[model samples]
Target chain A: MDALTPHLPVLLVLTPLFGGLLAALMPRRGPAPWIWSALVTGFEVLLGLSMVKLVRQSPQETITYFIGWWPAEYGIAYEIDALNAYVILVVALLAFVSTIYAKSSVEDEIPKDRHNFFYSIWLLAISGMVGICATADTFNIYVLLEISSLTVYTLIAMGKYRDRRALTASLKYLILGSIGATFILLGIGYLLMLTGTLNMADMHEQLMLMKAEGDLAGNRTILVGFTFITVGLGLKMAMWPLHLWLPNAYTFAPSAVSALVASTATKVGVYMAFRFIFTLFGSVYDSSATLALMAFCGTLGIIVSSIRAAQATNVKKILAYSSVGQLGYIVVGFSMANESGVAASVIHILNHAVTKGAMFMACGAVVLRMGNADLKSFYGLGRRMPATMAAFTIGGLGLIGMPLTSGFISKFYLISGALHDGKWWLAMVVLAGSLISIIYVWRVLEVIYFKKPEKRAPVEEAPFTMLIAMWILASASVILGVDAELTGRLAEFAARVLIGGAT
Target chain B: MEGLGLFNYWIAVAIMMVGFYGVIAKRNLVKQAISLGLFQTGVFLFYITMSVYRAPDGTPGRAPVWEAILDGFTKDPGPYDNPLPHVLMLTAIVVGVSTLSVALAIIMNIKRLYGTVEADEISEIEEAIEHREEMMSR
Candidate 1:
């Protein structure tokens, strides 16, 4: 462990990457590819664990690794503070579980011949996301973001065997996602022109120095750069108004792809926003107006998307809409710009990943057993697929913020954060959003348990492998809710690290 | 004089806007993909333009190359261009090409599935299919 400690961050990225290439070269049949991805992700979870341990051991709770021993002025640095180390662990854990879940689900949904390519692309996507969290270089983030985005586009397009709409969905996402990425590049260019640095911490220092010189305010270049970056990350995270490409992309993609993308992709985007808005830009610039705008957008997204989720007839579509609403909660939490608010955001990122990951996994299991995931298809599923629906129910309750579920914990913090800021109406909006979510959750439950099927058919529970994965996530959500001590303390510590760095 | 000196930026911005318009207004998927390429190229141009450094005396800098060590500090080396943006844009160009290829491949699949690459026509077909599905489910 001592020998490995220094290289933990890079290994977290490199293992899945090279492992992906090797998986692609394997013979084009059997469980070899699956086994390979499982091994890679399993190893990654260990690295993530070690990374968290290493960060906890550090006095400042931050680990900065300059690649190839290059000085901070010139080379890329992988900086792991408590906040990112926690997110990386969540990403690694979910990737491992989802890879396990992908076994039966992928075989059932995708063709045998494309299985190798699917798993290869899957690992590469995971690598890109982890790299995004681990890296401290602004330009490097763009490259890694594109790497993940390109692979995901291919993964989603692979769903054409099941539905042709996946093709169009991937294309739409490609266009819009590319535009968002280019905006980020331009924003980085502007900032680079200003600060003459690519290192995030260095950039922050430069911006702070500029502020000390009283040259930050009303600087058109910095303002434009900030706007471009915010809009770019907003699009990437599916922050409400910029979320047009998300629903179809999630709805049409294969089950495993949806599960992985849902549980990690947007959450990583939220992390990027945290890095840029807080860590990089910091308190050097007044972001109160932007936070207010973000909060308003988030509230609007929660209310509107909940209504849309209730209206959707397809279970996957409903979950996708629900995801948009859930993201609103995360955004609103951080937008409050208080410690508890930021902590709430960080906590929800983990909770939602677990809750939504399990729900999507369960939905995939249903899709595997039944041919479709429409609400009509779910009639009497409670009895037919008892364990799956039960897990699904727990995830649903988590979404609705029922007590003893993870969602309740984060929403409680979010409300408290709002009250801390004296935003009583915002606290009320949080409650109202949860109330609307209940309608969607109840809609699915009613169909699963109450509505009787007109025709009887023999059905069995999801395969054991998928059930194991689902329950792992489902129970984690519950356990975290029941014992919020570990995650709560971690999140509070992370929030302090973030706010401390900002000021 | 300053405005003329910054003319390259104006051109880059103009080209970028044209590509953005094409992406929004064009119905054909291939055209949109090509437009995306153009948009990325505009950014590349902007980066390249920024890499050129001007001395305070208004003299343009030479390309960044190691000449001082060979001369043993005998002469003052002129100000050189910022090479970092150029290196960064090289990576960006590669990424742009990768994105273009993926976009085109997806478009090809769209053409094969729908028999048309026009956005409105494809949506019309999808709407019809969705209507049929709703009817059958009922």
Candidate 2:
């Protein structure tokens, strides 16, 4: 209702762009860029929250923000409905919280000279993520996806200062990421060939008409386009099989990159995949054959990655593999194609973000203290770094989908949805994944609490700032689990919107 | 296939697969990067191929420009091709150039660190580093 509503879309994007440039230009000062990033995230989070409120309150439950006052059908616009509003807010919240946590971790991990540039790249990554989530234009998403991905490669490569392997890891990421982006672009081109439009809503209407007219060739083109987009985005999101580049990327990248990218980057890819499959290509991809394919891949990703995690020795690799498996849950939700299934996917997005963000940040705290995050290195840390360990443990419990955490809430909905859809085996597969994940979580717990420290182990808790940030997310995971009503309701609404097809 | 003149698309797919195979199948760092470039060119070719539109008599159109849309031009230029794909490719080409440069720069950095750009050699060095660390931890 306020004057800000119209400008909210472009402002959401531009604020971070200008903030990043400002942060990059700050005088040689430590933490100045950090403070700047914190402020930018704070402002963006408020904007995102208010945008979500405005969209939900609107009769149409969608906010169409046209850039430069162009008509909605012709110009670039940010389409925020129940689905992306939830994702954008979650991403902004994590970006803001992790920026606070990045201060101490970056100081210890990165060279002091790179801190300002690091903060700038971090802000750029956030802005790019916001752009990808907000844009209604399909071509624009590919451009923004490249924007965020390019910045992330640099952010991860910054880890080379501490561990040289980060160079190769980031190189692998760069090569793989380029391929993914190209595939996505190719997919967009295919759609343009069919509908001659890039605006998602317009394209949907065009596709509907094509289907109604019994356009077999058009449908065939769409199916090919859908495959290209899915494969490209699946690579980007680290889908189970094409996930060769993930473990090393996570383990060797700076801890802050691990947390931020783990929470937001892949989630954006997941969101795009969800939008393309359920919204843009709705009904077409929601059929039994496609859902069956997704269910198979999703379950396989879950079982395989969980097994890999249980066998891994490095803590970051374990968490990284765990993330791939967690993403599979979201994929499975979409595979169900029902209201509850889509809602569960939405709910799991937020839950996994909260829990994984906390866990990785805690790992960063450990790395900051001891300079390594090997499982063997966790011995006796529960006593020395009590607060950091507790945060990690609480988050680990959440990862295990234990009660009193957001993980429990997500799993409950996901399983119920699977059962309701008569895919009882999928529910069992999910439970089996949970059972496998417990072993890996327990591996960390046993090392941290049960084993005795070597004579030379360091004795110190993480800096208070890092612990504070970790607790913020770790506690939120608990609170969200205890009362899943809000996430549940919002996710249900988002799901209903998705399953009801684009309005 | 005979009526559609699909050979252009077939060639584009062939080039794309070759480039994709090089990227995934080759082990040399520079080879992989070059293959990435090749693969993008394949995509570029696809877009270019898709952009080609023939008149009713099978004549390619001119580039869309000021003369094509003025409504009072001396020579009546018939329907222009869809310039959208052309514009989209302009952006894609720019992105591909940037990606290639960044990838090459990373390869340079890797060579400086381990004195080798071969993927296997680099992994060998990495394994040596990991092996040493394992002993130290033990």
Candidate 3:
């Protein structure tokens, strides 16, 4: 245990990757892929917990591991700072629960022949997301992003059995995602040409030196590089106007895929944006304009997505639009560019992941029993599937930013930060968005609890595995809401780390 | 202005913009894929062009050739093409090919489902089908 302590982060990423490959090779048999996925995810969860423990013990230290024993300055490195450590825990926790949930939920949605392949690619997607969060190298992030995205397309395509629209949605996402990735690569090339280094620390130092010496070439190239990168990452994170692919993709995807992606993938993109803006380019670039862009677009995203959510008839589409709105709140927090703001964004990352994951999983249960995600299908779900409906209610309340839920803590800090910046109008807008969220969430609840059952057909409760996963995440939403010390401290530590301090 | 000249990058950029225009404006899926390929090739050209070194003696020069098997195995590094960018572009080309293959597969699926490869027509059909479904439900 002592000897294994230092390599936990790499193990968290590799466990899923190796398991995915092994699962793909396993003969199509009873439960082999599911068992493999669960075992690997269980291991990852343990690794995540151990790392969180280690992080608590050494709050100021960053755990840097270079692949193949290569030195950090030259080789690819995984930098586990306080922020990413928290994110790793969230991802690992979700991967574990989602895999357990997928066993039963996927059996219903996906065909029998496709189950093994589905689990294999599911683990691969998880591995890719974990790798994205853990890596420190810029180019390495793009590679991992492609790995995750390609598998995501495959996973969404798996939904062809349910809805053929999944194919078109996945295709659209592939095109836009490839364009975004190309832009990122172009920006990275520009940075390399100007600095002669791909190492983030080295590039930051060189950029500062060149700036101090008044090197126009360096400054101009860096600014161009930043523009290209911000736009690319913005598209990936689904910052408004660039989020064209999100609604249909989420709406048409299989419930398990929607749940996993809604919870983790975009959050990882948000993590990348935060890392770039606050860590790599924080000191060199005047991020005021960039922050203003984020604030303006984020505010618009909240308004647009909120309106769309209210108008959406399909349950998954409503949740999808709500996710876009929730992402706006996260961006708003980040754009505030203050301590509480960054902290709020980080906490929202975790909170939103849990809340959205639970909600989607609950939606999956409904879709499994009812065969449709239209809001009408949920009539009398509260009495029919009491546990699942209760989980959905909890998740819904969290989404609406109710007190004693994780969402409240994030909103509290975000609003305070807005007011701190004397952006009182922005604060009002944030509250208005939450108010709209409450209306939509209540709509769902009203249909679930108050409306009479349309049919008397017996609806079994969601499978035990699905229930456990949904309950776990839903419970975490409440537990973390009350116990903010862990997420709060980690967020504070991460913000300080990005600013080059221990706090 | 430099070794390997400035014309190469201009041509590459032009090709890239043409491909970009094709992708954005063309209605056929196959044409979009072809345009993407063209755009990627342009990016490859830019990398290769940017890698050329300045010629020694302030004159344009070409890649070094081996003489006498091992005549000290040394050549003036003047205008020798940077091997790094070439290697990188080779990798990028393979990635481009893989992406094209996937895009083609999606196009095939679309064709099988909708019986058309023209984007505007497919969308029109899809919208009509959706409208019909809504009417039937009503």
Candidate 4:
């Protein structure tokens, strides 16, 4: 057990990567690739859980795995700590749940023959996300981000069977995502040239030494590098105004694809935002200007995305817009730069994942049944598909920050943190944002429950496989709400590590 | 006489702007992809130029091979250029090409489905399709 411990980091990444490849290469006539992907994800979840456990139990609170037996000073290393361990577990769980959900959902949404390839891309995308969260090397993050981006483009385009809009959506995302990724590469390049190092921790140490010698602050190159990284990652995260490509991408992609991407991809971008802001350039750039900008963006994003969600006619677009708003609340909390603020950001990071995963999964089920995702089609959904809409209602109320739900816990923390920081207006904005969410969530609920059923087709619930997937996330939101002690502790530890303490 | 001093940077900037212009201004899918490729090339050129070096005597250096390392150490460890950027760019180039290929393939699929590569026309058709879908759903 001791000998195998250090390998946990590599195992976390390679499990899904090789599993994806193996699943792709499986005989077309053999068991469907979803089964393979599901099993692989289950294994990944276990691997992730073990790493989190190990990191928590270990004295150092971090597990550093150097690839190819290379030393940490130079070679690629994976440093898993409380911060990323929490994120990795989220990714693994969502990937597994979505995999089970996709088994039946992908069949009708995409071409029959492309199921295996889609599942393969799904697995690769999950691996890419896992790799991004687990690795300590900056370059490794870029490569993994690319791997996920490329696979996601294909996954979104696979929705062409349902809507040709998917083609344009994929194209737009590819073009924009490439630009974003290229900027990240350029930023990394600048960092490498300046520091002669790719290891994040090493670079941080070198920067600290430079700061002590008064050679670091206001350095144009470092400023430019951080700018590039921020802009690039900002675009990827769909930060406020940069989120134009997101609605179409989520609206048209196959439902399962939307659920997976909405739940993890942008969430990973949020993780990177935290990693870059708090982990890498946190101290160097922790100026009032940076925090103020984040606060401003978060406030604007919540208002804009919420109003948009309220106006949107399609169910998927509504959920997608709400997602943008939810991410806003997260951004606001983390930008406050206090312990409470960082803790709120971290808590929302996981809580939002569970709630949004449930929402999109439930929305996907609705799309699967009625062949439309527009609000009009949702009329009497509560009566037709009682279980699914129930799951959706729970998720919807969670989105509204209803008491005893994941969304409420995170929002409560976020608002309190803002108030504690003496930014009463920020707290007010948080409350206003939730009120706006109530408008949209109520719109969905009203349509689902009060209006009469529009469609006359035979009534049936989403298949057991998909419902099980949706409810697992839905129930998690409830459970997380009732008992946030574990999540709160984990988030607190992660925040402390990021704030340059206990690391 | 200043050894290309700022000229190299100006050219890279120009290429980069041109690619950005094409990507944003052009209507053709293939042209946009080609522009993206050029943009990638501009970045690669920037990397290559950033890696350039001059010896202590102000003359340009030779290739940074093992031979140069041996020579540098034997002497006063003369300015043998940093090889890291060049190595990193090789990886970047492969990634750039793969991205372009995928973009072009998506464009091809778009063409096959819509029989046009122009963004304006494709979006027009998409709008119509969306409009129709909304009508039917309602």
Highest DockQ: which candidate?
A: 1
Q: Order of candidates by lDDT, top first?
A: 1, 2, 4, 3
Off by over 4 Å in 2: A217-219, A284-287, A456-458, B1-4, B69-76, B134-138
The numbered model that scores best in TM-score is 1
Mind giving the per-residue lDDT tens digits that candidate 2 earns over A353-386?
9999999999998888877998877899999989
DockQ (C-alpha based) per candidate is 0.84, 0.66, 0.42, 0.61
lDDT of 4 by residue, B1-138 (tens): 564786887898788889988988999999999999888788888777778888768877656677656676575544667786788788888889889998999999999999999999998998898788678765
TM-score of chain B of each: 0.91, 0.88, 0.82, 0.88
Q: Considering only chain A, what is the TM-score of each predicted structure?
A: 0.99, 0.97, 0.97, 0.97
lDDT of 2 by residue, B28-102 (tens): 999999999999999988988888888989777777676655756667777677787888889888888888987
Interface Cα RMSD, each model: 0.8, 1.3, 1.8, 1.4
- What overall lDDT goes with each candidate model? 0.92, 0.87, 0.84, 0.86
DockQ of 1: 0.84
TM-score per candidate:
0.98, 0.96, 0.94, 0.96
| Residue A246 lDDT in candidate 4 | 89
Per lDDT, the best of the predicted structures is 1
lDDT of 3 by residue, B1-138 (tens): 563567887898798899888878999989988887787788788777777766567655455443323456565444555555566677678767866777788788888887898989878987886686556433
Q: In DockQ, how does model 3 score against the reference complex?
A: 0.42
